[model samples]
Target: MILSQKLFVATLTAMFTFFILPLFFVEENANDYFIGFVVSSVTIPFIFTFGLLTSMLIGNFCHKYHLKKIISFLLHIVSGVICLMIFAVYIFITGGSPEGYIQTGLMIALLCITVFFYIDIVMKKKSK
Candidate 1:
């Protein structure tokens, strides 16, 4: 995929994972948590920036070694792990509650995988 497509995917995945997904997972203080997330306005950009940069680096590495199929599958896994780590760090840095961490982390991982795979499938179909 091109850089532009990667960036677009990153932005979409970040937005969906951080913004929309949280609404369903956060049981307590749903409004407050979401409000805090929106008010901070830092999480989205942070996720998107790191997600984009890391995916790009991984893409380049995969291309360099000509491990397209293996790396493509690994890329989704890596992205999910990277996103989970970023979320954990962000939560720690902000002193957010640990209670919802697992739920949110799982959501992030699943969303990342879903979005990346969906995009990959669509792109492949388009190319074919």
Candidate 2:
């Protein structure tokens, strides 16, 4: 996943440098490049970084509180809910679709919950 994440980031950086940056120098050719592609591609890094950082934060929170599995799961839900709050803010200010933000947030929360539960099970088996 780390390798894949790095590749994704590098690709986005290269694309921005090569394709998007050139648009600034040549204003007339701006129509040659697709705005939607550039906008959407830029979001890839933000979602990926947010997911990773939020997952780490949740893990640390669980450890610090000595939370049970159920409580940890609930915490994930709470964090996911916070994403909706962000969605609402975007709607009010930006007037763009918020589905992607909501989906990314929920998916990352689910992924983190799944990993935590899987690791918990493995640790329990080792104890036995």
Cα TM-score per model: 0.66, 0.44
**Local distance difference test values of all predictions, in order:** 0.67, 0.55
| Candidate 2 error regions (>4 Å) | 1-40, 96-128
**lDDT value, residue 87 of candidate 2:** 51
Instruction: Please write out the lDDT profile of model 1 over residues 63-121, one tens digit for every residue.
Output: 79888665666776777676777667766789886556657567656767677657755
Record all residue pairs in model 2 with backbone atoms less than 3 Å apart, i.e. clashing.
none
| Top model number, TM-score | 1
Worst 10 residues of 2 by lDDT: 2-11
The clash numbers for all candidates, in the given order, read: 0, 0
Question: 93 in model 1: Cα distance from truth in Å?
Answer: 4.8
